[model samples]
Target chain A: MTAAVPNAFDDPAYRQGVVELLGLLAYGEISAWERLAEDAKMAPTLAQEAEVAAMASAEWEHFAQLRDRLFALGEDPYAAMLPFQPIFQRFHARTQPEDFLEGLLKAYVGDGLAADFYREIAAFLDAETRELVLDTLSGTGHSEFVVDVIRDAIAEEPRVGGKLALWGRRFMGEALSQAQTVVAERDALTAVLVGNADRPGAVMDLTVIGRMLTRLTEAHTERMDKLGLAA
Target chain B: MTAAVPNAFDDPAYRQGVVELLGLLAYGEISAWERLAEDAKMAPTLAQEAEVAAMASAEWEHFAQLRDRLFALGEDPYAAMLPFQPIFQRFHARTQPEDFLEGLLKAYVGDGLAADFYREIAAFLDAETRELVLDTLSGTGHSEFVVDVIRDAIAEEPRVGGKLALWGRRFMGEALSQAQTVVAERDALTAVLVGNADRPGAVMDLTVIGRMLTRLTEAHTERMDKLGLAA
Candidate 1:
């Protein structure tokens, strides 16, 4: 891909596409923030609650960065964020965690999946926007803390491993279904992901998209295994 | 206060009391985080939701600070936080925000009252500990965002003012009662707040306690008025 240029943003459709991606991400962070905070209540200890809240708040910081980018692009940050709300809400409603461990697995697995997907999509974006999106996804925070907690939990209760492994599968399924729903609705966003002619970098073929999904799946399985869950 | 010396921590009882107080504040931040996030779901717009989440995340940052302080004192942060769980849970259960506006008022008024109460108590501590608590309580993140939203809502619907005012009163009553429950249960905490004979600063009597409550109440009223609600 050629180096990104300000001239790319000069194209109104390209600007709108980038704005849409940012908006999708901004709302995604808000939804993640709410879910993680809700899960914090399920934490068995204050430290764990703090850990989850910390991750949720970290996600909000990313939300702010995205929103700021929207403003810098001369767009309404909230309006940009509004359209994708239902998509994320639907995803969360379907994958609601049943317990602290389930919540941990969801956070760990869900975050990893989203990060992988975004990283894959970034390949089709202009360098600046790609960097912004990747940075936002970089550490949406449910990191080592969730992993340690989930591993310790499965070790203590072997039955938990089976349940969470099932939960992990369910989380992945609901997420993919929601992604399909969103892609079906958001023509502009889908075009950006699938590589529209004017959509920044090299256009992606069906094969590339397939490979991306495969990579995301492999990453999800690895994360699930690390949590002592059967993928 | 004689310049805070390392010797103060050398007094095991004082150290224990400080640890207890940090635990209370840490748990308090987590509770605030949960409530704000819950309230975020009630927000009428994505903007409002982000605002509430922003405040909740800020509270989590404070939780980290308090937790770090606990660790610095060689205490297990979660273990220290455990004992105060029920107290905050009881307080939250009683003062739950029924909707977005009520949650805004709670975040605004409740935060103000807690900040005032903590500031008053800080007067009884060694300089270092006083500074730490004061710093954590400094900007509880319920400032322009909550006040602006509440003011706008009440301006649009004056009747909400009356209900929120009453809600504010109930919030105060519940908070005080829960605090009383905590003080009655944790003698070390009470000693830290009211000042034990062998404690650092001057001992507080009933009159002083009454005055502290008065100060917190006055601050609450001011905040309520800012929110366009009567106290």
Candidate 2:
């Protein structure tokens, strides 16, 4: 390995952007942890409850790692994470699942979107920070578990699919609205994301961000489709 | 090391007892995880919330290890964990924390008692099972965290200490009631605990059980004292 500081470190604004992006992603994991822990309560069986709670616990480990990295970067992890909390709170408030299956869908669908967005943002960061961001967003293998349960339930009752499809659409709408609110408020994240229009090395633009959103939407739809729900 | 099977394996009843004990301990951890995860919602700060959630996650790791070991022993881990759910549900319902401090107290005081009891029970099993039980019962380093917050809160308002002391006593009473109920219901556990009064190698008697409870109470008092609360 070459003993060279990554290009991202050559610019202070880019460093700030990396920290802001990580803080936002870190808060996303923390909120996900809280939501899944709440969801565990509505699980129909102890074994199933353990499965859901296991996912929630995995989020905590990710959050701890992300928070530590944020601290290492000379940021107060909690303060850095503060701006994103209300965005999640608003999204969760609007999208509270009516039952256990809906909760699983949200856990699966919601995390899928967040993870995809974070993975995209990782591209603008230095190698180490990029790896840390990716590490924090890795799913806890609960995707299959969530899919199995939701698909089995939907198969057993075809009418339930219509109700969940509508719910999925509502979840997607709420998430995007809240995400736009976060992007509006967190200028550092916005800058790190699309970069300056005149910056020679800028890889992100309105076009790139638009394509990223499209990719994220495609992934979310795939997740919902796997659960036998329409996006 | 000798490949000794240990004395507990000589008797099928004792082996059943080991399984029973491990099952009970595993369920205790699983329940603790659920309760603490639920408790995380009441934390005043996100940092404190993560602290509580981290403890809950540690419990899941312990439960996973125990569950895998139970499967290795040709037992259905969930079935083994089933008998203790209602036991915990009853205790939690009776002692739901009214606020964040109360939740912290429950997390601390409740876990202290459970850990102490399990540590005592660890002595009666084969080496492997004994170690597994002990490992699961290890505290997630929450003692200092809980004590620091509770003591600080109480210091801010002296009257809060009195209220929490009463709550601690209530918690202790409810725990003992449920524990006796468990002792009454789980015959395999009972047989393993007291070692059959007529058996020549009987390791426990009414006297030993009495002493165990006494020691458990003393430990609980010390925990309460550490928090500057009355037992």
Candidate 3:
């Protein structure tokens, strides 16, 4: 199906969408950092406590960069971000991971999906916007330390695999639900990406998307298995 | 005041108090890092946001060090910290600064007074403990950015002096009041410091205490003036 393509920067709706998405993500990062830092206090060792706190703080740089890009796009960051509060808040409330492994799984799943989503959108944007989105998505090293922890934990507990695998499924399920809601409610924003691309239906390649998700799941499973979990 | 001096570390009451105070302060640092990471959202610029988050994260390291020291002294980190929660929580709640400058002011005042308090206690401890406390207090670069901000603000607005000066007063009043309360509630702890190698009273030297307070006040006033605030 043929779709109308528009210059993203010049489209007020697209620019506003950018602002909205960035603002919401920025706020999310700030809150995440706080929660992670506090949660670190539950750690049995001082070393782990410091590690979590530092990881929490590391999110701020990416949050700020995305925010700055939004501001530069002339969007009212807060206003654009307001529409996302309900769904985002609900996700957090529903998915408060009970254990350290669960928390790491949550991060691993969330960051991987987000990175994938943004990477897809980046392809449809102008060169400058594409670079910014790509940079923002890539710059935050969210998965490295998380993978390390999962690996170490699995090594210590070979039987932990099943619990973590179940946890991972739940985490992804919640995320998918959020994505569906966003798509259903945000046509203009979706249009900004899907309708803006030259190949039109190229954005709707289900096989490609499925492969990406499968790969992510596979990687996560491998990480858990390496840790001796029932992946 | 002819006060009987007690060997603080050896004295159960004093040792407990020391543990309690230090534990609270250590936990406070950890919480502060988390809060700052959260608060960095108020920053309008990404660079500034990252900087604040980094500082917040760094607090965890200090917290770990202090926690280790507390454990070394055979105290329950959480138990020692439980008593001062109300006072500390109240102070933080009342002084929730709205923006970056206010946040900086809070840090500056809190860190400065804490360092001074640590120095006072260091003198009464064993050489190793004293050295550890002093090193921890001195190594933290809490006020470096604050001084830069104050300098810049003063350069920008000459009339900001009065407002900041008042802020400084509020900070000091609250800190001093809490400190006095902590001290009054724990006479054995005071005996720990005052009773040392010399006569407890001679070791404390009320005149020296008065002089240190005066110097701190003067330094704060000078800072306010430099920040173009009324000193």
Candidate 4:
């Protein structure tokens, strides 16, 4: 008979949960790397390809860092990631970018939520692992690219504002939907953010979550306005 | 009325051919980054993701270097790259990898041929361009992955020999077919490798090309055999 897999909801779950989450994140980074790298082909200039390629490399580095943390936790990173494959795959399928701008917006909005989620979880981790996740989140290139492309597109064609603004909205909606699914399906993962013994405010309710999301939305809107996409 | 677009194959063509080639190469590198990064998700451990992510990152760096070289030549890198989009997109459609191993093998064999082609073209370029191309070709991570995966797979499953060996054959056949198409359709690109100034024994001909193919085939065969797939 096959052995039943250990549930990570317990302290026994620590090793498995750490490994699995890291694997999932590593895979996410990997997919992001490939998307950005390949999309660089759509770039109109050699210089642009270089810029996108560099950005894609940052995703790969993030994957590496997460993988390293998984290793430190004694997780078999690939096995840990295997369970969530369909989930991540479905999310990507539902949100496939149609063009260069869509691609950039996907990265920008998608990584923003990812960073927020990781920040929440990092507080549950030991110092070293938390530091690694923090550093990885800090290294995001999506915002820079998003700001540059939106500004350029607006500067070149003021008519792009209506289309891109709508596209940005769709991107955010899809990303938030996937994040909610992730949180709902994984209670232990939620515990990483909400069950901390040391801090009373470590866990937040729906109102606080809504406020955070609102702030992010406001920032994104401001960025769009700065790029003349929200005139 | 729109001005006549310059034919790239014409003598004294205004389009910068070298930069165009670099754009294509840089795009390929970015695509490689994406493929490898995504494939790393199939890994069974975090360490494996790290290994694959590092490989993906290397592809990005290669694209960066090629992009810089193109910029130095005073061409608008994007404009140079625009002509070959359809062809590249078609190649990608026809040759999508089915799995992690397939993706890695694609990188290994496909990029190896591309590196050889780049080296041949480098020989035809002036001193600076030659050095730049050579430097870009030197740091490929594809072969190392190929060797590692093939070796490990063979060690783990002695019976996987036939499937993988057959897959290797398909890889080479598809690659060579696409290469021929590239050579036939891209005349100036052919000129880049065939040499602007002919020298006896400097440029490769059909016989020399055949010999090189034979070598790569032999190496691939040896790899398959090492993985216990020779039967």
Candidate 5:
């Protein structure tokens, strides 16, 4: 049993931080949806395109849920998402996938990274917001599809694995750089992560934050390994 | 009450015709989904992009339903869709939308044309197949959104109306030409339309087919009128 509106919302800063986090998450979904849809265009076959398109639709559905939550919180969803657009745009621009395999690797690796980071942040959020964040961040149930496709491709051509492995590293680098920019610019979101003075119980100390990063990296490595790509 | 599988499907030729028709319709949806997703990228704003993305997802949903029906009929969904892919590809290649407004108009008017044509064909189908065809052919509910957006744009720049009107005509021309090629090449699909020797009752004579064409054209004109464009 949980409160529909958490007591954490009583603090104005906490509420603002949650709103910013939701905005970021929602925008991330929209960005993922757009990129996946674009990747579907380069799919090698119609069946593969449909699979990617299904993933895109799943992302859109998650975005809609986050958007509705923003509305319920009395914020303009689009306006909330506006500030983070350029960060994602730059990340996507710098890491544009050159082919179908690159696209699959990016979708799997990039999304895995974002989901890990968000799950860490969800730890500091109120129950309701945490639940929403975790639920939406859950994979679109296509990770196996990506893993199978990439593993088969790599098996067919040993050289392709080397290229995709390098691609994964580049995607992670770009994602982290963009993420750091967001953290530096968004005080409210940073407060949510490290926990502000108003939310003493949620405080994550420097060591804890460091450990979170290690966990994220390890998870990413595991995903890359699953795809037969080096981290 | 309707039969789960129509008695009409008992005839091998009729079954082949329906399978071919479903293949064509499913492929049309996948094609529309791809094009709509492309159109979303050209959207002027994030909100508009989401709207278009929603329409794309709607198209994908229709494709899934049709694909499932194909599977139930012991057909490979992708293989069913393959034969008609080139026809749609050619149609899309010739009528590529040049901008945001053109994309919107193309989505609205082009889908309207396809929907009208399919509905006419649905009349010749058995009750179950007719229901599926009609259900999927139904608009994605974004017609009003497209109408409002295009109407506002034309209002802002009166010249846009003239340009879009011409664009509308070009889309219709390309669609009709591709449709002609399909009708000429697909003997089974044509059999569905004209009523084959085996199914005397389902046979639509030349006059009826001509009237169906007239109705299709009138619907297209009405849809164009709704968009404040000439048919």
Candidate 6:
């Protein structure tokens, strides 16, 4: 089905959707970088701070890639990123971590959920766009760092796990709420996921989106469990 | 003199000084990254925020290089970075910018001053270590970005030049004060500047140190002039 249309950019609706998706992802990277850098401040040691700073740097690199892609498409990269700023600002403001542990959980669980959702959306995109989207979503290889820190924290103070589990749930809830708002407000991006009528071979019915959400949920659950937190 | 220090690393005093210098630099990079990221939040536009973030990422990259070099020298990178953390913390705390423009100027003027000081010291080191130190001190190619923004800002509001010029002086003063503290507290690093008797080729007299400080001040004055601020 994906092979049926080699030039998805030919469809205006598809182009708009792709641009919206790229912008959303680009802004998401910037927001991630900001949040991770903020979290680095709460790190207990210089080594841990450097670890988190490294993650923030990785996010900046991803943002650069997406921004360049938008520029190559002749879209003003900052203008492309503008529409989603308020949404991200609100998400971060509402989910301000109370402590270092909550911040770590948010980075791991929140980012994991967002990446899964974006990857799901990427599947409906043109091959070139899909590849770019997936590549950007490929996280900074610091998940194990986050996991180890969280697990060690929990092992030392058994009660800390419960608080983190709750924080994980809050992150998921905030993220999903924001995701719904994005879907409701961004018609072009929604069309990317639900399939635009004018964009042939891009048609995925409601069932597909439902299954996609389910997969995203299951993946989030798996990640939470890995961190010894209940989803 | 440079050719005579082929095995400078074998000298215990040289090694201690080298390690101390690297630690100072590594922490400085981390501190720079933190301050730049903080400044990014005050950016009026997303593009400007990204410009600042890019600078922060560049610092992180340099930090990685210094950290890896420390590791190769069999020093614990975090321990190497620890001694200078409080000094940087105080420097940043005292020079917190009041607004976006102040932030930009601080980053430009402050970093420029710090780089010049370090580069002057780098010249007295072993060739290989000197090269690494100098390479890390190279300004991220975003000076033009900072210069352009500040010039346009001053052009738009003539009064801004006066305020930023004062800010520039304050940055230089604060940096010098903290730097003096670093030199007084860190005997090994000071030893690097005032060569040890055992480290023959590394011997730099107090006269050279005085000239180095003069060169640093002259460079700072030139940078302020470039930014249309009185030194």
lDDT of 4 at B71: 70
Best by lDDT: 6
- In model 2, how large is the Cα lDDT of residue B13? 72
Would you give me the overall lDDT of model 1? 0.80
Query: Candidate 6 lDDT, tens digit per residue, B1-231?
Result: 577755777778779888988998899999999999999999999999999999999999999999999999999989988989889989888889999999999888867876777677766788788889888878587889999999999999999999999989888888777877876677677878655524556544556556766788899999999998998
Best-matching candidate per DockQ? 6
Per-residue lDDT of candidate 6, residues A1-231 (tens digit): 577856777777788888888898899999999999999999999999999999899899999999999999999999988999999999999889999888888888867876787677766777788788788878677888999999999999999999988877777777777877887787777888865635566544556656767787789889999988888
Task: Estimate the TM-score of every prediction.
Answer: 0.91, 0.93, 0.58, 0.68, 0.93, 0.93
lDDT of 5 by residue, A36-116 (tens): 999999999989998998888889889989999999998998888988899989999999999998998888887788788
Off by over 4 Å in 1: A1-6, A140-142, A194-204, B1-6, B194-204
Ordered by TM-score, highest first, the candidates read 6, 2, 5, 1, 4, 3
Judged by lDDT against the true structure, how good is candidate 3? 0.64
Model 3 bad stretches (over 4 Å) = A1-35, A38-210, A218-231, B1-14, B142-144, B150-161, B193-212
> How does chain A of every candidate compare to the true chain A by TM-score?
0.90, 0.91, 0.78, 0.79, 0.92, 0.91
Candidate 5 Cα deviation (angstroms), residue B148: 0.9
Residue runs of model 5 more than 4 Å from their true location after superposition? A1-6, A197-207, B1-6, B194-207
True contacts reproduced, candidate 4: 0.52
How many clashes (backbone N, Cα, C below 3 Å) per candidate? 0, 0, 13, 13, 0, 0
lDDT by residue for model 3 (A108-143), tens? 666666676677677656777678778767745656
Kindly report which residue stretches of model 6 are placed more than 4 angstroms away from their true locations once superposed: A1-6, A195-205, B1-6, B194-204
The local distance difference test score of model 5 is: 0.84
**Which portions of model 2 miss their true places by more than 4 Å?**
A1-7, A195-204, B1-10, B195-204
